[model samples]
Target: MSEEEFRESGGRNTVFIGRQKPVMSYVLTTLTCLNNSPDVILKARGAAISLAVDVAQITIHRFAPGLRVADIKLGTEQLQSEEGGTRNVSSIEIRLTYPPEGQGEAAKA
Candidate 1:
């Protein structure tokens, strides 16, 4: 699939997390592919540490048992505002890395 298609499909995988899950959709804004792997950087809307965890759990179930907390790196930062006044909002960035493309051969190396 094209990158856009892949991203869209990947986004669908997280739909369950947002549906009926309070503050989940608000917490996660976008999911960007990183380093050409399943590694994704989840851009958050506000300080949503728990929301991020919820997302990771959904991803693990969708992907496989190989998913681990260590593989999913988490971070946060404030967004830049146009005006002088700084907003109270914070963003959580999560880095989720899955296994490489090739499995059998790569495993030996």
Candidate 2:
């Protein structure tokens, strides 16, 4: 989903990982988790996929060990290239879910 659409979903937390530095992505992910969002979706396209993965890892392992990956969806979209030709670009959605109270890491494992 687009950033605007994600934001419009009241209870949903979403982050778009673009070409910016990975550190910035990490910070945003951390903040989202700290905000008590039950689930967070990390979206990235094309070359930014690796950066998105890094952000998710750092957020889960380092920042929020209690969080776990709930699901992942991957696909490609056909877009008009700068050269005016159709091109297929890869996209990914990584969903992280925080366990409910009293569940903790045991439930995740």
Candidate 3:
């Protein structure tokens, strides 16, 4: 979801959507979300699924080693395009649960 959509979700801001940004940027975002909530869900589609995994790993290993991957969900979304009538895209949701002991400072270093 977009930034506006995320805000419009009514206080449900624990989700981080992976995009074509630097891995560290995504890592920071995930850490920020984790600081605010008990769990942060990283969602990505297609090629971004790999990036999402990398962000989760880096956030766990580098910033919050105590963090746990509570769950992982995989699915496919069908989208319609002008050229291609319909195409299937892979999607993944990695749920990183349990905030670090040092909450607010998770992303400081």
Off by over 4 Å in 2: 1-12, 33-36, 107-109
* Model 2: worst 10 consecutive residues (lDDT sum): 2-11
* TM-score of candidate 3 on Cα atoms, chains taken together: 0.75
Per-residue CA lDDT of model 3 for 1-109, tens digit only, reads 4335434543453555556579999888888877788888887777888888888898899998778888998988776656968777787778888755675345667
For 40-108, candidate 2 gives per-residue lDDT tens digits of 888778998888888888888777788888899898877777798988879888888887787886656
- How far off is residue 102 in model 2, in Å? 4.8
- Sorted on TM-score, best first, the list reads 2, 3, 1
List lDDT for all candidates, in order: 0.46, 0.75, 0.75
By TM-score, the better pick of 2 and 3 is 2
Alpha-carbon lDDT of model 3: 0.75
lDDT value, residue 28 of candidate 2: 72
Q: List the residue pairs that clash in candidate 2.
A: none
lDDT of 1 by residue, 36-73 (tens): 34555553434445676677666555544554443433
Each prediction's TM-score versus the true structure: 0.41, 0.77, 0.75
